[model samples]
Target: MSFKSLCVAFGLTLSLAACAVGNTVDYRDVVPPLGVSGSKSVAVEAVDQRPYVLAGDNTPQWVGMVRGGFGNPFGVHTVSGAPLSSDLTQSIIDSLKQGGVKAVPATARMATDRTLLVTIKNWKSDSMVTTSIYIDAEAEVRDQAGTVLARNSVQERVVNEGEVAVLPPGKLERAKAVFRRLMDQLLNSSIRDALR
Candidate 1:
């Protein structure tokens, strides 16, 4: 190619690199599991414990960078449109209620309610020509004065490759599947009973 052609190619690459690679999709609204009877009263508090501080935050959000690859990790990130902690907290409460449990946010007072602390331990993706999403969370129930009653954790992963992985629907949509799986396990696990 001519010198002018090379210069134009380099400029084009630079402009593409300058484009935003951040993703923003809310990770809520999983299908609630069938409500169970004789569930217990509990207050829920969710926390995001992932240790990475990513780039770009124009709104209240939760973000995790996609890992694996050289330099900036494909310059992509997985983000949620709302603060993850509160979103999980509310989702947990709603799920518990739909499951026939008396559930509320930690801020709500109760006569004799167990406190459920749910934590986001990991939320990440790996990609090259493929994208693999992973997520895990732990839920612990404690009595008044913080005596642990029960604890359980759940994790999920999904891999996408070939044509679909690099095509439309984006990172956020791919990640939502893993998040849904994570929530489903929480609803049907021993942790839900322990909260009672």
Candidate 2:
């Protein structure tokens, strides 16, 4: 094959790889250990309201874009998979369990004393030479009667401009750290007070 032809083939291969992967981030991969336990019964739910990946409808890669994308010329945005709300919901569950909270999914049939509703106002990670993760969310503690007991908002913007975030899993690990901070911020602040 001609040298020019080889170059084209290589580019095609990289783009194809990007598409095949769909540039997604699984929230389950970012759950952190809370090291605290609670017997408090609560149901959790999350709804994503960002407009991005695939026109921001409902699908994976909602975590935001860390790097390359298939047909996306600007860049690729990471996804959560299928639907974002589900991913956030599960992530919250894992985080609560790590804290030893008797947490259950809002959609489940288990009995719960209170329900915590989380609206993902915005969650994204964009990186090229450097990576930055910005997460904004609102959490509400409600009684079994659906009365709001406490409301809290979490917004954090962290920029990892170090050489590490420019690497492979480095970017991913950076995002995980943000996820941990996000949960940590919530549980320690309003959530903790409400639970206590």
Candidate 3:
């Protein structure tokens, strides 16, 4: 190859290397297993018609590697190709109902016993050029009046060195599953707290 072409290739390689070296998923702290029983019930408002933030919504690339593979590796957002807010929200609502909860209709104009406002502050993912995947999320819940009820920012790390699934099924599916599971835990905790 021409000298100029070689120089360009070297520069690109260095740039990519820099990006790779910059961010690494860190889940060193031991994360205790999530022990949530669906027995408890919380008075949750009907699923809001508004879009539910997709798993890894507004997530960063670095966070992706910790949870699962990025939906769209080339896209700006790591989990960009994941379901939309509405899809995710509906999924959660349905899961909650099945698990055990009096779900209100999203269109109900009247406010119910309790309303929950969830804000997903950050979601991120990461993976090497060849293989490996993961995802993370930071979320919070508030009451109808906007009082912070509880906040949690945790990263789910699924290190894929070779051929062992951190998730039950696989990484991508596992990420989605984890998202739903996290929501379940949130509901469980919220209900337990509200009842108290």
Question: How much lDDT does each candidate structure score?
Answer: 0.61, 0.66, 0.39
Collision pairs in model 1: 35-99
Error of 2 at 160 (Å): 1.0
Across 48-132, the per-residue lDDT of candidate 3 in tens digits comes to: 1212233433322323332223222432222333323333344444544553554443445444434443333433334433233
Q: In candidate 2, where is summed lDDT lowest over 10 consecutive residues? A: 69-78
- The residue-by-residue lDDT of candidate 2 on 1-196, one tens digit each, is 9999999988965754454344545566454554546677888888776655346453444555544433332333344334667766787787778777888888896778778888877777766556678888888888777788888888888887774324435666667677777767765556655643
TM-scores, each model vs. reference: 0.68, 0.71, 0.43
Whose TM-score is greatest here?
2
> In candidate 1, which residue ranges exceed 4 Å CA deviation?
1-22, 53-60, 65-80, 109-112, 126-128, 155-158, 163-171, 186-188
Compare candidates 1 and 2 on TM-score and give the better one: 2
RMSD of 2: 4.8
RMSD per model, one decimal: 4.9, 4.8, 10.2
Q: Which candidate number has the best lDDT?
A: 2
10 residues in a row with least lDDT, candidate 1: 53-62
